[model samples]
Target: MSVRVQADPNQPQAQDQSFSAAFELQGNPDQGELRLYTPLGSTAAGIQWTPINAVLQAHGETRQFRDLAQLITLVLGTDVPVTALFAWLAGQNQEVDGWQVDLSARNQGKIAARRMAPALPAELQVVLDN
Candidate 1:
């Protein structure tokens, strides 16, 4: 999976950034784990969350957060529609506020989405290995 975030013109500090990693996302929106791997296939980061808390482990350090959404926002510099993302991955076209998803290439194991509102704009692209 790869993610690219365009700098928000309204935010002076925001800068364009891109990330690519092999990731595994499990469970539902309320309780789940998202693990990212490096290009060499080693674990890069792991995020696990429940209704109570979210934990991020990376670079030999573990940090806790109030929730998955907060943790994701801090890391990505924007909020992602995680709940809708799960549905989209499952071949369901779910509408999410401020975001648009395209699943035409889902049969080819490809998914693309873009966020057009709410501060930062981002583009997310995923290619399933399976």
Candidate 2:
């Protein structure tokens, strides 16, 4: 699925890195691949991860990560609750440890969530293509 993520810099955990990216992620959060592209549709990076090994390819170079969290945090500048994403995408309001999700518009192919407890509160919005 295609997604656009916006990280608020005001969030303490955001570490002053305000990022916005449009990317396509495929596979399951447990074991899957993600391809991040430039707005113009060129590949910026690609990541494939499994329980044992995770690899990220970018800038014509490939690097291996010890785990998915590290790989994703390195790329996105923050750790996203990927496991909860499956539930969110399915229109289920599953709460992560520090995040609150709103799925009222699931039938409309839209959902939004936010981090509430953590010092850094960031919002996530998703719109699935019909």
Q: What is the C-alpha lDDT of each candidate?
A: 0.89, 0.75
The weakest ten consecutive residues by lDDT in model 2 span 1-10
The parts of candidate 1 lying over 4 Å away from their true place are 10-14
With a 3 Å backbone cut-off (N, CA, C), the pairs that clash in candidate 1 are none
Which ten contiguous residues of candidate 1 have the minimum total lDDT? 73-82
lDDT of 2: 0.75
Give lDDT: candidate 2, residue 30. 75
lDDT score, candidate 2, position 56: 97
Off by over 4 Å in 2: 1-16
Q: C-alpha displacement of 75 in model 2, angstroms?
A: 1.5
Clashes (N, CA, C under 3 Å) per candidate: 0, 0
lDDT of 2 by residue, 7-104 (tens): 46666564344555566777877799877778788988889989888999999899999988898777765677888887898777777898888888
Candidate with top TM-score is 1
Question: What is the Cα-based TM-score of model 1?
Answer: 0.92
Candidate maximizing lDDT: 1
